[model samples]
Target: MPFWRHPSPSLQPLSLLLLLGTLPLLCSAATPGQLPAKRIQPLPASNLGSGRVETKGPGLYELTAERRAALETIRYAEGTWKGGSSIGYRILYGGGTFNSFERHPDTVVVKRYASAAAGAYQFLPGTWEAATRSLGLSGFGPASQDQAALHLIERRGALAELDRGVLTDQAINRLAQEWASFPTASGGSAYGQPSKSVEQLRAFHRESLRRHQLRREGAPA
Candidate 1:
């Protein structure tokens, strides 16, 4: 048998270059039924537009594109109309925070209104209590208020239609009962002092739908 010896040290660099050159081809080769290993990449940052990123955990974020769309939609339809987080109707009506228990003086249906309409959405006391208790919501933060409003929309069975941009007048009328700003079938206030006309509500909703579609389709805001 011939004696085996190590290669010369001068050849080591050339040997390393050849091995490195073949390494890629070796790694790229796979069984007939298998695929080559894919390069793992960290996730790209979310494009949630102008909304601020809300941290949910140590590394988790909540400001996604879909979330921004929903928040914007609600802001236009509810927050903008009711009084935004700042200087919204809830505050003037003596209702802006969860702890707000002040009664609105406006009367509806010949009865003196007593429930507090608090939060950006202007949730009535009974409505907020029922919703929060049923949904197990801990507080009335922006996220919680968003969830509660969306939950009400889901209950009305209009969420799917709204998302699809096919909500009808009838659906809108029905949903309007859930909000005082919108007119009812009889064109009367469900709650006292609904300042917005039906035409205004319709226009707002139409614009909202258009904006929603724009965002969903990746068009400019």
Candidate 2:
């Protein structure tokens, strides 16, 4: 979909992971340093075919043309965070839309941004806005209205075992075509294979698990 298409109406410009004041989804106690296994369904950024994705998080690098064209297998990208444990919000661009990825353990959530979410997440940086208008490039509303959809089965619950294979043949085909046609550098709510995103997801999950253990042992946050 286009950037103007919003992902969610209720969510505001939440560029950081939100502690929505709800009880976290319950999960089994896992061994130290081990991620509690959960099903992961990926939304493709650029028509990349399905591949193994062991983690979840936003990607940082822009999807390049070569990366977009050569992504026959899922390519994951990496992300950076300021806080110690990476449970925060960030506005990462994907193929065509900007979506949200929540890592609340058993409550891992993916919400495709609606118009509101787009407005909430758009980068109306002071510099960019002035530059565009000076060059007669209209306004930022058009750029902020765009959004992406989530491929997750459960809107609130963690991914399931069977859901791991959620990436279908048709989805991959559609992604490939979308990448080829998509004009922007990034926007998405789905997972990429083997790209920098994949690594970030893995690291996020590992740290989340570590944090869980720390909480259990009463470590300082």
Candidate 3:
């Protein structure tokens, strides 16, 4: 008889039974205390890693380099401290009436102290109109306000100094005169006007400039 031979049917059944018995233990040992947890998949990248982001709001738009710098200037100059808060439509007041610019048909008000500047950049009616006209923008919405302020920033040529983070006393004073709520180079607001301290203004400018740079570097705005 040949030494090599098939296992008997009974032996085959026993081997199969042993394998079935070890299957559960093998699986448990492979997985430890619990089964492997499922992982969530991340969102697929769009346009081959372009990293484009979609945002919502009034001022939300394509943030070009120029637009980012313009927005930074506005934040430093106008968003710091105005009327106990940042400049907005809510700040527009004159003689206790809302929207002094609207109350009077003419942009010029007979009483300078009677009116509170309006918009994010705190522009008077006359100044706002002039800036808007130059920029070919119309309306009092957030986009229009931002565009108008950008024009003023360009006209003043303050973007360079803002970019350099080296604003001179003369330069700050010139801007302070335009925005009553802004402090002079000496950290003093215009005569008979409220303004943030120089230290606060510096902090704001630095932070805004840093953020603007980060945004330009592909960080979210």
Candidate 4:
């Protein structure tokens, strides 16, 4: 693979390329081999008719069709179950409200979403292709090993991209393997009170999205 090159400062990754709807994407400067589903498209208009949804902050972007969508808030989780490998839960919540990780073999790295208070989700590092039954404060589990790629979470709020980024071969296999291991676990974030009232749930997402825009646009949390 070519050396990793960051996108130009002007080439903002959070901007949306609204096709039929919205696809969140950015061509990897290192390898523009195959374009990803969440592709970065130029904003044809300087003002793309967006509101709080797209203007909040954080690295998240929204897709607008009949209505504008808050982007990147949904949390897509992937991890091991036992020695057998496992797929994690799927959840969507406001930035920094509550977020975490769990590993089985190694030490569990605790992470918090600073997106709201600090304007960015405090990221946690996971080793590729290594499984550990470790757990964190915001989240839980001494998760199993799945030999997956880097666990990816979409920027809190956008529908753009698949929402999870585990592209390398090992990561892909681990994700697929773990996803295969526990079909139900891979289904949704039914693990906690991510939502109760549908509207509140919806608002959690909306609030997250606005914050995403704000973070992206350089607003402090």
Candidate 5:
């Protein structure tokens, strides 16, 4: 069963704004005193398969090479990653874990901090609800999560730049407001928590892009 029903169109914008505004205080990738988790290994190529993702609005968004790499880069910074393993989709906030994908884990992890964030993109319950409604997405599977994350990037107005393989400072800054793990232009977390440096994210993005390009060219990644 879907955990969220579609919100009325009339109320969507205001509701989404309120939910997103709380992200900075509620969505830190790691709690205080802990560094973001490092990637254990690369995800299998099978995990990178492309799919057609539909939006509530007109036009379709395919998971293209550059978009996939950009999504992976965001995953890398978000600490929910374990080499892009499926386990990342089961992670709860504050190092806890869950086993279901029927819905957002909605488990408020309390340790150094408390948050209901879960999955590869660390979506809070409200944020996830908003995303599902906005993108007409269902389930909490890896594919759905990826679509939702991309929807977020699109909403932040950074998806075009990312698709162009240009992760400009402006794009990163726009995204930083939504994902605390991404650093702002001034190289700091919007929430004042630890964040990945722009250089680090750029390096990861470059490597990911290279791998995707190689795969596209039918060569070894």
Candidate 6:
């Protein structure tokens, strides 16, 4: 079954609740003879927490340090960061790479579940189209994916809370509806699929914040 259906009330359609026992291995595996895509390197330690906000298309939003860390936490939960690389940007629904970022690689991969979800955020085609149109994003590259995910967070009304460095249970609960990987208040996958624990998410976010602070202070990450 498809991961999402169109004309849903939410910014993203509900995801397919498929058995994901092998999802981790699928996420890290590349297709035969397909070279891994170049990774989008992390910002230098000196650049973290420099108070420099990256403006998304037409300055629609600023990616502050807290917000960036929150996004990274989402990526972590989504199983998109393969071996510390941004190969997730080129990842298809189940696993495997797409050649171009000129647009969402709307290829539905059929494993235990079928989905056109792609990119680091696993945006379905409909979601990606909506985000790109809303944000004037022209590509499916790393910056565009980040901005798109932020837009979804904003749609869920959690952006302000995230910016305040308050990744509270309430905020996470609100975001859970958008990303299946995020646990709900009860610490289960909102979609009845695999998910990370709320405790794990909180811990990851805290460590990410600490690492950013360390970078800002010229300490080792």
lDDT for each candidate structure: 0.43, 0.25, 0.43, 0.23, 0.70, 0.66
The alpha-carbon root-mean-square deviation between model 6 and the true structure, to one decimal in Å, is 10.2
Give the poorly placed runs of model 1, Cα more than 4 Å off.
Answer: 1-115
How well is each residue in 78-158 modelled by candidate 1, as lDDT tens digits? 444442344343332233233332332222111122223455565654555555554544445555555556556555555
What are the per-residue Cα lDDT tens digits for candidate 5 across 45-153?
Answer: 2333335543344533568889989888888888866886878778887767888777887776555444678998898787787667655565788887887788777
Q: Give the Å error, residue 214, model 3.
A: 2.1
TM-score of 1: 0.52
Question: Lowest-scoring 10 consecutive residues by lDDT in candidate 3?
Answer: 24-33
Write the residue-wise lDDT of candidate 4 on 1-221 in tens digits: 12223353112222232222332221111111222323222222223323322323332233322011111222222111111121222111121122343321212212221111110111222221111111111122211111011122121112123233212223222222222211122332222212223333344445555555566678973
| Residue 7 displacement (Å), model 3 | 99
User: Pick by lDDT: which candidate is best?
Assistant: 5
What's the residue-level lDDT of 16 in candidate 5?
52
Q: List the residue pairs that clash in candidate 3.
A: none
Q: Which portions of model 3 show Cα errors greater than 4 Å?
A: 1-91, 94-113, 165-170, 219-221
Error of 5 at 87 (Å): 1.2
The better-scoring model by TM-score among 2 and 3 is 3
- Per-residue CA lDDT of model 6 for 51-117, tens digit only, reads 3424322435566668778988888888887744868778886677899877787786766654567
TM-score, every prediction: 0.52, 0.23, 0.51, 0.22, 0.76, 0.73
Flag regions of model 2 displaced more than 4 Å.
Answer: 1-81, 84-158, 161-197
lDDT of 3 by residue, 48-139 (tens): 12212233323222445545444544444444234323234333333222343222122222232223245555565556555544444434
Counted clashes in each candidate structure = 2, 42, 0, 41, 0, 0
- Which of candidates 2 and 6 is the stronger one according to TM-score? 6
